[model samples]
Target: PLAEKHGVTIETSGDVAVSVGSHALLLQMTMNLVHNAIVHNLPERGAVWVTTGVRSRVVVLAVENTGQKLPPQMAATLVEPFQRGTGRTHTDQAGVGLGLAIVKSIAEAHDGTLTLTPRDGGGLRVAVQLPAAPPDTGR
Candidate 1:
């Protein structure tokens, strides 16, 4: 998998029940996060962790990776279109830098939120929280 190519370990845990959202948009959001986690990671000791679960009334999905420390301010701007982070500007793997931007946009359309935070030691963690769907009451 992509994790192997980057010498990163993939850890996944937890389970999230189905929620309401556009399948295509959710898949796109997930792909972007996973791709970024692999493409932008520490040359050594790279690791990616994926998790999903229900918290309170929300469905949560998180993608985290071992990477170089990202400037907090720059991390905030990463969700904006065409904005690239440090060292990303010169990479052939770099796209137009709209990955996170699109993820954030799609998240909002589904009544969800996207957050980016720098992890202790090193690396970044992104969490997407979406409102859980109401239980169906068959008539």
Candidate 2:
């Protein structure tokens, strides 16, 4: 919804089947990630790409978006508190800047890891990797 309003499109793909200690917390973390993508995207022709997969026994949820180029140093700070990038300032929605920080905390609490990287062309890629749930033995 917000993507459409911002003239940005969203594309989702891949296997998202994964387990987490808390579904509610995972949802919250996902929301923040998605929100950051949309709110920081270009004015138009912008896109948010979300993909999930299992790699090396870890479940990966990655969210990427089209935006400005961020320096490696600046990009590293995005997960810190109150570290909002030079995101789309003209947009109607602005955040209090705790988005990525909260995400980092949630990922760590689940024994997972969060990674933020600057895309080669432009934009940012955010990934959360969590341990896959153990197979249910019905014990």
Candidate 3:
């Protein structure tokens, strides 16, 4: 809904189905990032891009969006519980800021890592990297 409303273009690639600790947790993480990409984007001309790939023994899931730049200090604390970006705390789009926090928690629980990088142009890029599981063998 947000994507359609903002006309955000979503481009995806790579093998989406990969062995992970928990599918449900991953779904939640990806959904939150994607939602944030749309909600926190520019009012117009917003864009989102999602991709997945395997790097070494890790599975990478990344979401990138176009929006206003976030300060380094704010971005650093974004994964903290209840920490939200400026001007986003009192608007209709206001969030409790638990989204990224929860994402980070879940990643850590699975022995993975989550990173948020400010984009070169504007907006942010979030990536969650988890250890890839060995292929299932016939039991």
Best by TM-score: 2
Estimate TM-scores for all models: 0.90, 0.92, 0.90
Q: Write the per-residue lDDT of candidate 1 for residues 10-129, one digit (tens) a residue.
A: 788989556798999899999999988887788876889999998778999999988878878878988888777664456566577889999999889999999999887678899999
Give the lowest summed-lDDT range of ten residues in model 3: 85-94
lDDT of 3 by residue, 1-139 (tens): 7688877777777775474677898788888899888888888878888988887788988899998888766778888887676544556674777889899988898899999998878899899999887777977
| Model 2 Cα shift for residue 8 (angstroms) | 0.7
Please identify which of the two predictions, 2 or 3, would achieve the higher TM-score against the true structure: 2
Off by over 4 Å in 1: 136-139
Give the winner by lDDT: 1 or 2: 2
On the 0 to 100 scale, the lDDT of residue 62 in model 1 is 94
- Model 2: what TM-score? 0.92
Worst 10 residues of 2 by lDDT: 84-93
Tens-digit lDDT track of model 2 for 23-90: 89999999999999998888788999999998767999999999989888888888888767864334
